[model samples]
Target: MFRRHKPSSSEHKRDPAIHAPALPHNDMRSFFSLSQLVLSAGHLKPPPVLRHSKTTYFEVEILDAHSKKQICVVDKIPPSSTLLDVKHKFHKVCPQWSPSRIGLRLERNGSYLRDSVNIKALAASSIITLYFTDMGQQVTWTTVFLTEYTGPLLIYLLFYLRLSSIYDAKESARSLRHPVVHLACFCHCLHYARHLLETLFVHKISEGHTPLKNMIKGCTFYWGFTSWLAYYINHPQYTPPSFGNKQVTISALVFLLCEAGNHFINVALVHQNQSGNKGSFPSPSINPFTWLFLFVSCPNYTYEIGSWMSFTVMTQTLPVGVFALLMAIQMAQWARKKHQLYLKKCTTYRWRKRAMIPFIL
Candidate 1:
């Protein structure tokens, strides 16, 4: 499971090795910055073992910045080794530098690369420092969703809540991210917030922060996205040029259906997941039935698109429209990727489904 690597910095000034073994003091806190520790934690993720081993192994050259020298040459590396792993080996030699502190770069099949990609399991190397700064952000992900338009903001909130409720633990982490999430998303978000702290740290829980207490937070977290939308729509003294109750009602119905669909799909996948069946029968953790169709179908993604689309239809605001477009594109990209992974990994996988879209696409 582990390989021994030679530590030789080809570039840096050669300093005397500390052969003296005093206290193995835990100054890793000193050597590793906060971000570095998190990066290391993330880097600890092991590669998914593939069925076949590729030939034509690549030689990754590790450059030592100190001496401006090309130090060690890593040979016969499996295609499975990530650019990050290469840098990790480099760091072993260049102990004076962490990935965050070095000028690492990757040359993949002799080309400079950008973005997160799996290059057909080929021979390539990166300037460990630069690649990881970009790569780490991909692996450690967190972002808040906000709608530019106010009317359909509720729909966005519902969409976010629907996705997050499945991974409820993330909400508690969000409390550390922002008190606003703790204060006013919606009763649902607050419910999850309470669920999180109680699930993890019960003794230090607070009643005021309970999802029930933060009605405003709950509303904003789910629907109160555009502060001005509600004000303009429900103003007591305001009069509308024309009212379209039928259109509004239909949009609301679509939004509700999407919300329900997302909730059920996640529940279905979670229930059917069998990730622990490594011995006799194979099992997946949240195995879904979306792959049965032709393209790589992700029903959750379908619901997500629908939810946002409903928001756009209801609000008809430029910001909501743009956000919906971005979300749809991103969701399609994700669904395609997952479908591809399933196709590549599973012998029984069927490729008839077209992502979130049905056969027409």
Candidate 2:
């Protein structure tokens, strides 16, 4: 029923085999085309990849203190730590080593580094070589002071109680004890008891440990002197002072006053430490005994010497006098050293002040 028509040139040129083929859904070309289209439209982005870099750490080289031979090299140590922390790390490598036993030195002849020193605060270097020294037997300062004080207190008491065989048979049968002897025993005991108490409760003692040899030497000095004084003072032939009861009363008063003064001074110093008032010179506050600070640099030593002097006067014995004189000499030396330290540490310290005495050395 349709009229016949001639075929157009485009339709005559078109062939089914020559036409471009449509891409399949799973084809690589189809995927690439889809990715390009999404990228051009700014709808998708590539994911980020993480790459790890080599970790960096500080190096610590340890060497024998005496021989200077390499002992061990510790690597990968964190810089934000302390010498004490480093010691623990070293302890892990050498199970036998301990923090207390290890002493680290920056130089061959220099002093050992304190445990509180920070690792990062040290001089900057690629490798830090620390001299390792084994600290021998050590004891705390508190233990040394307690032992030294307690020994003298008990040893002197033994003499006063007549428990030792040093006294004669006739003297042992005496009816009543001498009043001066009784007073002397009380003063001696009180002096050492206060010292023990201060060392334990009041004083802010540093955490430094002392060598056993030094402690032995100190104990020898204290124990030997105590025995000598106790023996002579409690002797049967001991005589009262030539000035009689008046001299005894006056000396006893002086001893008690000085003992009280020393205790007050110690308390004030402890307060000073707690308040963190280090730079300024220490001045007396309500306690008049602390007024000695105005004239003398080491008023505590001055009070100590005065107490011993009063004891010497009360007993009036050659051994007691000798002990007081020797103690004075030693305390004088300590006072001078402390005075120098105060001057160095506190520039505001008065230069007119004497070391131990009020106006004389």
Candidate 3:
């Protein structure tokens, strides 16, 4: 009878406010309120992320080479930018200076930086300093070449036609023109015509430009030489070759051979360059004309000299001989420089190859 008394529903439902242990408002309530505030804020908006950028940028400072004066500062350049890109930016800052006419170097008198060089490679820090030189007025190499070659052709033709102003009209009409005179005209025209054609199609001329002064000087030389040579060759009193048909025939044959060889060598050089072997030492190819490459570093110059020499012998004129000699000296200088460049660039090149000659230059 004194067993357990059954709890009533009202006793089971004791007051939650009195029976439940009170939470510490300083610790639990504060933490709960703080957590609830954080959750509510998070739901409303994401927390701002303080991220650091990893991208690198560059700044370039260009100064005058001689005066050391500041040209301009190009900023915000990417790491992948090249010298060409810097040149473009510099051009924007200074529109008067063209990219081609803008020469940049590390030092005042130092060699210019190539357009292909990377800006990052040249930089010692995020900022790079360059010396700028305003290369004077420039003309395309093609324009220079065309002008140099065309003047001689037209000048030679003018003399050959024997205008009344150039030659005495009565003497020119009475004077019997030698068979060699006509032949010499043919050869001269052929030579210049071939050069014009080669300039247009065959040769791999540089994209670089020449100084306007240099082009003017070159034109003066070529036009002057053509005038001097043509004046004597086509003169009314001009004589035939000394040894008659024999000397003319032999020299003409030599000239023709040399011209053909020069053409073949130039073609081979173009092919080599097109095959991605640019600036490399040229070697002998399947073509017999190109075989001269084995003996001469500049076979084209050799053929050029040979053609002139044969022309001198064909005409047997003092002016032509003098022209040949001067041309030989000039070509020798060019060939020597080209040979030195080949040797410098290609260590494996044959030492026996002369600049222009086969054995002795």
How do the predictions measure up, each by TM-score? Answer: 0.41, 0.79, 0.82
Two-way TM-score contest, 2 vs 3, winner: 3
Query: Which of 1 and 3 is ahead in lDDT?
Result: 3
* Candidates 1 and 2, the one with greater lDDT: 2
* Candidate 1 off by > 4 Å: 1-61, 64-68, 71-139, 142-243, 267-296
* Number of backbone collisions per candidate: 34, 0, 0
Q: What is the lDDT of residue 157 in candidate 1?
A: 55
Score candidate 3 by TM-score against the native. 0.82
Per-residue lDDT of 1-361 in model 3, one digit per residue for the tens? 6989886778768856656788776889789989989988765757799999887899999999888989799999998999999999999999999888999999888998898899889989998999999888989999998999999989999999999999999999999888788888888888888999999999989887778899999999889988998888889999888799999999999999999999999888888889897668877878888899989899999999999999999988888888899899999999999989998988788898899999996
Model 2 over residues 186-236: C-alpha lDDT tens digits?
A: 999999999999999999898877777788999999999999999877776
TM-score of 1: 0.41
Q: Write the per-residue lDDT of candidate 1 for residues 253-343, one digit (tens) a residue.
A: 7876766656555554544454442222123234343332334357778877787686556544455566567668877889878766666
Ranking by lDDT: 3, 2, 1
lDDT of each structure? Answer: 0.47, 0.86, 0.90
RMSD of each: 28.5, 8.2, 7.7
Query: What lDDT score goes with residue 155 in model 2?
Result: 92
